[model samples]
Target chain A: MSVVYGRVALIGLGLIASSMAWGMRRAGLAEEIVGTARSAQTRETAREIGLCDRVVDTAAEAVKDADLVVLAVPVGVMGAVAEEIGPHLKQGATVSDVGSVKRAVIAAVGPHIPDGVNFIPAHPLAGTEHSGPRSGFAELFDNRFCLLVPAENSDRQAVDRLRAYWEGLGANVEEMDADHHDLVLAVTSHAPHLIAYTMVGVADDLRRVTDSEVIKYSAAGFRDFTRIAASDPTMWRDVFLTNKDATLEILGRFTEELFALQRAIRTGDGDMLFDYFTRTRAIRRSIIDAGQDTDAPDFGRSKVHP
Target chain B: MSVVYGRVALIGLGLIASSMAWGMRRAGLAEEIVGTARSAQTRETAREIGLCDRVVDTAAEAVKDADLVVLAVPVGVMGAVAEEIGPHLKQGATVSDVGSVKRAVIAAVGPHIPDGVNFIPAHPLAGTEHSGPRSGFAELFDNRFCLLVPAENSDRQAVDRLRAYWEGLGANVEEMDADHHDLVLAVTSHAPHLIAYTMVGVADDLRRVTDSEVIKYSAAGFRDFTRIAASDPTMWRDVFLTNKDATLEILGRFTEELFALQRAIRTGDGDMLFDYFTRTRAIRRSIIDAGQDTDAPDFGRSKVHP
Candidate 1:
């Protein structure tokens, strides 16, 4: 748990980057943390909040001589950021990313990595609706699963070091092939988001017909969809764009099943509705049993910190 | 706030009935809260937990001399229960119900109400995924909205009295025609439930293909669907069957929008995806601003006390 990386450079100062910085400091995993943001205002704000040991003018300068360089940019910008840091990354330095889509990030950042640096593409399946440097906390990675999608012939020593780094920050790590990772995440995150966005859009358009009725009675269940749909537009846009194939695959299955349910509703098949509802209830129970989610519907109604 | 109804009776005690009983007692809105269930075991459990003042054997007995008879039964059973309690309901009594579908409940129960009795259908826009008497809490109605779908030519006094009773329980009250209420709720509750149920069914079937990856990597947002799908099967079965028209209407609209998004994803139309995502995000923010939902993306982080 001692400082493993003397200099840990975070390329983006968003929620993931700031949270990792907090975790690094809290766990004493990094002696110095350097960060860079595209906008001067965010860099200034990140510095004001003490999100890192040093704030840099460019990705290359931030990552220069750093023992571990983390790419936390949008998926669309991963290639450019990787190219910027490729020449300056220290020898044998471990390079990693925290993007939602794994395949696209690997494709974009893979070529830019210096041969000596370990390019480990990891996605920590943890986040809040909030974003930006000021929004992170130390325990954000606690008990969360982080999937590392490394090349088949990735250096074991580099992989082990990166594993140790995430473990030190309190994340449980597993490794998978990049395509399988995308497919798994397509079912878990990407399709759910698109469906949520679709439903929210429908509800919004229906508001034109129903006026404020959607907002008024939303406490029933539509409210939750709204929250999921309210995710960062730019981030989700990139996720859909980068994770297109897998997302489309799952969405196809989803729409097919939705059509079946729609037919059941149209045909007055109550039993079909009941059976589907009953089966889904067990899945929620399984998630709770797996220790991934809480059994209580609303986080046990826990109080929020002021 | 004086007692608005003396000798109040509730038939078919489940989430809504039990919650109504608890809230009525807490607010002193009912002089005596009597209840009836189909089985003696439930009656005993209801009495043991103080869910009702007097647990009765028959719906008819429970309704005798009651100034307000709240039919909190399954949509499918509304007719039978109304017929049984029709003769015993006291003259000048106000009869209201807390069923999801207003038009169906009215059609089932309308003929049974005597000339002097007023049948004011209501859909209380409140509940948790949990069911049964033990799940009930007095504060479940606090800050929630209640829709009173009063029958045409309904008694004004009875409507006002019921409104006062609900207000005493800390709910905002609105009046809508039974048909309109069913349509509005079909969008907010029924359609959402069907979609959740269908998605959960899809995931459950994918268990073999995805193995435990579905639960382990559920952080991607599939967990929310599980929670929504875990709601009571009987209640939702009844919702779909009773509100078929509105649910189907909304389902058609949802499918169309989902298809548009799916096509965008299939064609790599980032502009369309971004626009849909951005539009949905605004609706979510509006719902939060309207106070219908918390800003929390994961309600599991919430500490909502029952």
Candidate 2:
């Protein structure tokens, strides 16, 4: 593969940015890659690991003369980083972001872009519970959906180039409006994460069941919730803060369904519970059929006999 | 790995019973294994899969002259099955069960046992979303917990022999009271399952996000919930109906915690959300350390990059 960009600058040295750098290097998507992080420890770790071709002290220095500038910081800091790097962005460079929420990122970073530069917002809907620069690998985005949300007046060539770059990283890229992206993500990711956190927290607070017992017997179902709830606190906090309306809307629907199920349990309505569970079972089949997850038992968890 | 029982009878040939049959055969824990299922299809499947040495038509026939009897049916029918087999149970036989709720199984199956028989209740804290005879494997119980709830004055030799059999099958065994087991399971399994079902149901009912989109974008977190919610409907319905008090109690606590998190989200309280999430993260680490789950990224999911 040939280089799509002369130099690419990653503004945050975290899981997504580190993975992008590794994947791009593996596929030769960029001629040179530079990265910067606010934390001195993170920058030092990235330098030691050879995460990029160069590690710079500041975002402004990293973006200077770069053909592609990726704002990979937390959602809350995307605007601030954009403002800091606005004056240093190269003329005609393509500026994009990898924030989970699209509308807020566009609103925060759109105005700071210079007239000649093109701004395209993209979100790769893929991750594990692990975070940090050390937790990334070249295959993180492989077979995952990377939704690109281009502003209405955005340059067509810029959007297509970004799509090609993501494709080179092994992601299937699709175009979506900002509002639809947030709504769809809220249904799929944001609300489910919050609900998992709540369930884990509730289990933690139960005094009757010791923490050790919960941990020991976690294979039943609670372990899955813990894995989701264990995601990076800062990233998820920003997601909830930025995608407030959609998360709350889906959560409201979740509470209503929960109440109905609770009523069925209280009333001993076996039929209602059975029908609801059966319907949900069909959705799992669809997800597996669509290649989102495996059909193996217990996600093919390891069997370690102690 | 010597045979511990002359003949063992499994009343229902589902995931648990079939797995027990396979595991017992692998370790030579029982000389002869006999099984029966209510549905003709299940019986045929059991016979085809060789799940048991003998696939009998009636629970009474399965239990007749057997040294050990295991009632592995749904919680709601444990009593009926117990009554059917009680008269046929051999004197000095040990009767056990594999229900999720211990107190209810004890109450339902305890009275019918003949005076000379030893009645004990057990719950295996392990299973997959898949069910039926075909889904069983010898390694299903590896490194899992099997909690035994024995009535006062239970025969010590019978309890010890059962523990040895489970150990031979690669499960760690523990003893607990019936009521305590119910509450602990409610915290670990029942409430988590109900919450997953409710969340999936909410996503399914949403008109804004089509089912295909939900299925496609499920890898984030919703996919795990769907896996849990895909569990057998009849078994889960019976669990909720039988263990109403404990499940309701845990769900009430879950709702209270969820409301607090929801309020924090509405008010943009990032600190509160971050703190709660960070606290839950520690529990996941403990689960990994306890060997209940693997720490591999994305649960070691298969990478199918298209």
Candidate 3:
């Protein structure tokens, strides 16, 4: 028989945590879920929204008897949340987080975790551009991958328990080091988001072109960047701050590549431009073949699940 | 009653022309739609797809008795197409185009135009990543803007006539100078596409990161860039070649902005990153208000589209 964690504590009621909470209740994976936030209004909101079984006013109250505690706040705030809840966590409990940049998060939150608790860091590679408690959906983890970065000295049983919880919510789990996670996400997500945010910002600053015109003409290419740029500001800000090294490393490579392309454009090197575009188109094909997304809106509604 | 053009000839059967053919037919705005392509295969495909009323082998044959001619090929091919059609165009005929880069296209095709022929350069700021006749849709122009770039010396009647033709196809027409059109699009469309293409290419070239992983985790942000990179290689190649100056200028601005953000990330400047993200988010909001796209999905049948 699958056992539900007796008292699960979620320190932040943001998109990832709220979704996890909803998923836990929906799957009956947790016997009782408790949540705490820095603001009283978020706690009340969590209670009203049924985000948790108990919405405690203080972090200490939230984690008092919890067997599992998840920190789903921005990476920059993970240390503070960890410090606030450190003394209150139940003995031998498993603690984890869903921060994008893992190394900084683990570095900041690791020292505060009690010696007995397993501090496993994980990231569920799924989300919409929207954020906050209300923006989360139970099916967000459907068909998605959860990356786990367990400490070398972490208890094996604790890792399995957390894996089971995520699997119950419909995720495929894999393990990697915190450094690898930061680098992978830096290339695939962080740098891409930064480029998008920058381009959208440039378009916004141009007085010669109206914002209406920019949006109206966005179908050509700009709308995609806008969607990416629309992602949570606070979350992204924290990501940039925490994953500074890897992100800057990727950004350096990105700018170098961009400069080469710019040089090709200035010199009217059609062959170079054509070759670059030709190579990238295959990547899109690979992404589709991997079943990451169904490219066919050519057919009817595929699924309305999430 | 808005009058249909006596005869409309489209030189080149690519995405833009195919879409225009569908849009014109659906709106019942063109008396006859004639198309011409360099390749026998493309002409056959155009005929098989029923994109135009008549698919001719020669541009001259297509433009012979036409009142309006639309050159919808690569920007690099515009001059040759214009030269072929110039002698065959009827007196008082309006000749226009759907090139992404305006000034270069105008300069290239301008010298070949007959004295009596009205060369009104226009670009429909619309397309999909897919190309060719099979991808055409009537509603492509329904809510899209068509920008017309007419020189100061151009005939007023011809410009008005071409405007009527596009408006009849359900496009809202806006008049702009060719130079200004190139500059605006260089910033909004061309440069953004180059950046996306470069980033995707960078990801493709990296050996440390697996392609499958990048594809799997793309919902983070990379999926959006593929949409632009998937565009026709030849067309985009030509766009970069023809709009070199303006694209490079905007690209310089983009690099400077990107470097500034990179430095902030390196310095762990959370305040700077937060403010930057917050500022960029507003532009997306304004774009949504402009009806370019929904806050989530800009395309139809997408989750964000209501």
DockQ of 2: 0.61
Off by over 4 Å in 1: A207-211, A300-306, B207-211, B296-303
Highest lDDT model number: 2
Q: What count of clashes does model 3 give?
A: 1
- Which stretch of 10 consecutive residues in model 3 chain A shows the poorest summed lDDT? A297-306
| Per-residue accuracy of model 2 over B191-235 as CA lDDT, tens digit each | 999999999999999999999999988877898999999999999
Q: Candidate 3: where is the Cα deviation over 4 Å?
A: A1-3, A210-212, A296-306, B1-3, B298-306
Q: Top model by DockQ, which number?
A: 1
lDDT of 2 at B128: 83
The predicted structure with the larger DockQ, 1 or 2, is 1
Each candidate's TM vs. the true structure? 0.96, 0.97, 0.94
Residues A2-69, candidate 1, lDDT per residue (tens digit)?
98889999998998999899899889999899999998989999989888989988998998889988
Candidate number that wins on DockQ, 1 or 3: 1
Which residue pairs clash within candidate 2?
none
Chain B vs. true chain B: TM-score for each candidate? 0.96, 0.97, 0.96
